[model samples]
Target: MMNKGIDREIDWRLRVFESLSYPTIILLPDRTIIAVNGRYLEKMGVEEEEIIGRSCREVNLRNYPEQKFPCAEQGECPLARAVHTRSGQSVLLKYHDVYGGEGWEERVFSPILGADGEVDFIIESIRDVTRVKNLEKMYSGVRELIDQVVQTSVSGIIAADRQGRIILMNRAAEELFGYSGYDIDNVNIEDYYPPGVAREIMRKLRSEEIGEKGKLPITRVTIRRKDGAEVPAEMTAVIIYEDGREAATAGIFNDLRDKLEVERQLKEAHAQLIQSEKLASLGRLAAGVAHEINNPLTGILLYASMMREKLEKDHPLEQNLRYIIEDTQRCQEIVKNLLAYSRQSNPTRQYFQLNEALGESLRLVRDQKLFLHVKVVEDAPAAPVLVNADKNQLCQVVINLIINAVDAMDGNGTLTLRTYEDRPNRKAILEVSDTGGGIPAENMSKIFDPFFSTKEVGKGTGLGLSMAYGIMEENHGRIYVKDTSPEGTTFALELPLVPMSDVILFDSIG
Candidate 1:
């Protein structure tokens, strides 16, 4: 009965060995295959009679020559290694099975110790791991593709960790920020935004008012550049999550300098079209007025000259006669201005204090009827802001801007004139701001156009800004809308600066 139980147990062990999915072989210490499972016999397409008692190394070399590692070329395999180390060993190999299928295989060799702790036998098992290996390769390729796409994108992409530390920045971001890889190492992400901007962005990102929570949609914002300039940009940002918790944040930015410039040009072009139409209609009126006034003005000039010549020197009537001639000439000048709505007059260039010209412009209209209810505030530094430009034309531009500001306010508002010295760019900026309703969006495009005006027929000629634009261009200067809102509008005029070293020292010589 004991012998019968022993035979039953052996049969059960053989059945379990055959049930393994992986190919299995039992080998002796000398690399000889002593026993083989049914799985191995089936995979090798050979009967157990052929592989049993055969050498494991010889069978692998003859049927599975593609098996690699364990220095098989040197007559050593994982089976031999397992016996020598008294432990398990593994090797990866590519193989062709009996059914003509090809894939990756993990060959493992586990030593079976005897009662004396000596490796008496080894078990060789081959596990097909092609699916796992293929998955890893696919994952690697995907990661590489994502990295390439980010680096080559036109929009600037930046990512940061939960600690607000900058962790990644793409090539476009580097170019936009004017920073290098080594330059921004260990830099905090908050350093890129202006004061309180990062906090506000985070707050909005978490709030549902502006956009979906954890996502800030595309919107305009200001970023602080490496050179200390506040640049306009459009940005979209999102919070990264891991396991339902915030992990990091990423932002995509688009520079708006070029876009804003294109819009401004389009507006200017439209404004010019409207201005031209009005100038054409009103130019005919100016011509008619000049023609009708010239004959009468010439007659008065001739009679006044004769009367002044006949009168004695230092006589009271002589002075009155000279006044008539002078006043007539001033009237003639006024007529010339009427016809000069579209004229481009030459300017005399010289070095002058920009602040002085601004002051002069303010003084010329300080006591005027329109200025009675207007408050003028000058915000220029005490130091002279010198510029090389046409002094008269510069003052004319300032005066025109002031008049526009006053009119925009309907004769009752604060007019602030501010000046700034931009020595780095060698520019002098003068801004005229007024507390009034902002210019209409539709009218903004027509402001610089000929004949464009918001005023009534007789109140304006629609040529003030057109003439101002032409004068600015002639003087190598620029004029632009500095800032505007429902509460106010500011127009800025920029001119080239005259360095102190080049300033004439007439005062010192005298």
Candidate 2:
């Protein structure tokens, strides 16, 4: 018989167990179900009386009928382990219902001790863990997919902590920075940016005006490579947060070197097209003006010469006739130059050596008074660089460029003429560089425009460059200012090169 206090203690423990939310059961040493809580009855889909006197294995099989061995006999059975160790044992097990649906449960078997510290009964508890397992599996799959995308991306991908320490960088990022994975490990992100740029970027990312809601707008920046070269890149960045706190930043960037080069080429081509149209309009106007002025100027020169011969040297009107003759001759020269600017004569092309033509032009200009104080440097190749172009027109272009360079230097600076062959482009390049004050920025675009002169009034007709430009176009060549800076200026003339074999064949035919 039990004491009243001991019986009440037992009754109170039974009540607590009955009130628990998890499925619980009490088993005798024989492994028979002696007590079952309401939760256990509901979980097993059975009545309390139906499970109370049943063997534990029989009751468990009511819910999971697919077991090939009894639960108490299986090696991994929680109850069997608990019985052998005289302690608690827990395991994850698959349970199946009558409809063949599967579920996961954590089954725990804990021994209940008697007054003499011997195992009398065992308490079994079952907790469902199916939803948690499913969620873990889904999260793992998503993480793996995101990693794959980042690794295979064409644009550079970088991730850094809030303190700007590099945590992750993709292969494309390594290629862009010219650094390998081992080199950038744990390095500060500022090491890859131009000085102070990383700090400024972080400041902007934290500001609402530039970055809001953790997202930054796409922008362009210059980043430094490991080779100490700078590259332009377009980048977009975003802040990553963990549990409502700022965590890290991620950026995606694309190298802009190729894109910028294409844009520059397009701009140059467009500018050339516009200049060509303007020159065409000016050429038509020049042709018309030259024709209209030629007849009147010719008649003025004829009548002035006739009157001058009739008048004696001592005649008072002789001096005035001389003046008229000189003025007429000046007008005729202007008309002739205008016709040349209009390209009234077609070029007769032939294969000629560029170095020979440059030498002759230099010889002619070196003796002129304007070049007396200027030093000319020739950097021509030892071998002849042959081009299929009009020799006279090319020489004339060379002389005009030299004169202009000399004038720019005020006849007291160095003028360098260089000739070389660009085999890949099949062209011969002639460069004229002067150590003079560079062309003004505002005047650069109009340098090839007809009648657009930077010289003083009456000093230039502004047709020299326009005429050179026309002659080059007719010969399938190009003339352009290569560079201009405060230090000096360089003009380049490119003409199509002819192979020596072709030149020999043409000479034999002639």
Candidate 3:
């Protein structure tokens, strides 16, 4: 009865061991397989009798001939290690199946100690880990490729976790923000944005009304740099998802400083073209009107002079005749000015010193009633600043600018005439500044337009600035408002400088 009870207890233990899911086996210290569960026999496709009393190496060889030796000869085998150390040991190994297919498995050996505190039997459990290892390798390769793409992109890329902590910042982002030695890890994404901007962006990215499918449209924003300078950027952002849940947010930014500058220059050029076209149209109209009025004014002047001669000395009508003659002469002068504005006579181009031309213009206007009380200051360079332009046309431009400056000051403030050379550009610059209330903003754009004048009627014909603008253009020069404020206004004239070699050659020829 004692032997029967002992046998039943051993049978109950074997039944419990066979019910386990994993492929499990029991081995003696000699490395002989003493017992295996149904799971092991099913997995190996072999009957229990074929492996029960066989050595572990012999059993492995029957199933996987490619594996020459089992745990005993294999270096650091889990079963051998378990027995030697009298503890649990685990290792990964490669094995082949009955159909000549290979895969990986993790084998764990737990040594069961006897009363002598020595390993008596070893229990081994095998788990397939081939799919898990392959997944890890694929994930590593994909991560490396993604890193390469982000690092090489021209547009800056920034990625942050759902909690707004920065996770990745590409090299472009570092350069855009002027951060070369700054640490970025765990830094909040809001720190890179201006006040309240990051939160607003995230809100737009999350709202379907503002964005589409977790993506925000490209928009302009001012981003503060590491040095506290604000830079304009065009940005597009999207929310990243992993396993159907929100994972992170990523933004792509393009610096717009260069692009915006290019756009501004194009706009300025377009405005200049439009102004030129308008001036050309008005010039044709002025020419026609001046020719029609010139003959009548000449007839009137001749008749008024004859009538003045016909009047007796000290006669009441003599003074009236002189007044009529003087008024007709003034009208004739106006017609001549109109013809000049219409470009009836082409410019006779010549090289001349800009300061001399300016001086001539100032002398012509110095005795005028409008300039009698005004202070005139000249700030020309000591050396000659020569320009290859028509001297008479330049004189007209300088005279018109000076008279306008005097009128702007209402005959009380200062008029400054300055000449300088832009050596790098091979050009000469003439600036006429006035200490007057600057041009009103509403009139600034129309100041050069024909018939657009700020002066009271009869005080101006509104053609002075328009004529000056045309003369500068005809000479291949530029005229623009250099600076203007409530305090004053400065008009600049840029003309091409005559080279010293050309001047010397012309002098020798002369």
**Total clashing residue pairs per candidate?**
10, 0, 0
Which lDDT values do the candidates have, in the order given? 0.84, 0.87, 0.86
Candidate 1 stretches with Cα past 4 Å from truth are 1-12, 65-70, 73-76, 96-102, 165-168, 177-185, 224-230, 264-284, 307-323, 340-510
TM-score of 2: 0.76
Report the lDDT tens digits of candidate 1 across residue range 290-394.
878988999999999998888889888987888899999987876776655534346788878889889898888677798989888889888888888888878
Alpha-carbon TM-score of each model against the true structure: 0.65, 0.76, 0.75
Candidate 2 C-alpha lDDT tens digits along 236-287: 9988999988899999989999999999999989988998898888888989
Instruction: Indicate which candidate wins on TM-score.
Output: 2
In angstroms, how far off is 343's CA in candidate 2? 2.2
Q: Least lDDT summed over 10 consecutive residues: which range in candidate 3?
A: 67-76
Q: Considering every candidate listed, which one attains the maximal lDDT? A: 2
Model 2 weakest lDDT span, ten residues long: 67-76
Off by over 4 Å in 2: 1-127, 148-155, 209-215, 241-244, 300-330, 382-386, 422-427, 497-510
List the candidates ranked by TM-score, beginning with the highest: 2, 3, 1
Model 2 clash pairs are none
Model 1 steric clash pairs: 271-445, 271-446, 271-449, 272-449, 275-449, 275-450, 275-451, 275-452, 276-450, 278-451
**Better-scoring candidate (lDDT), 1 or 3:** 3
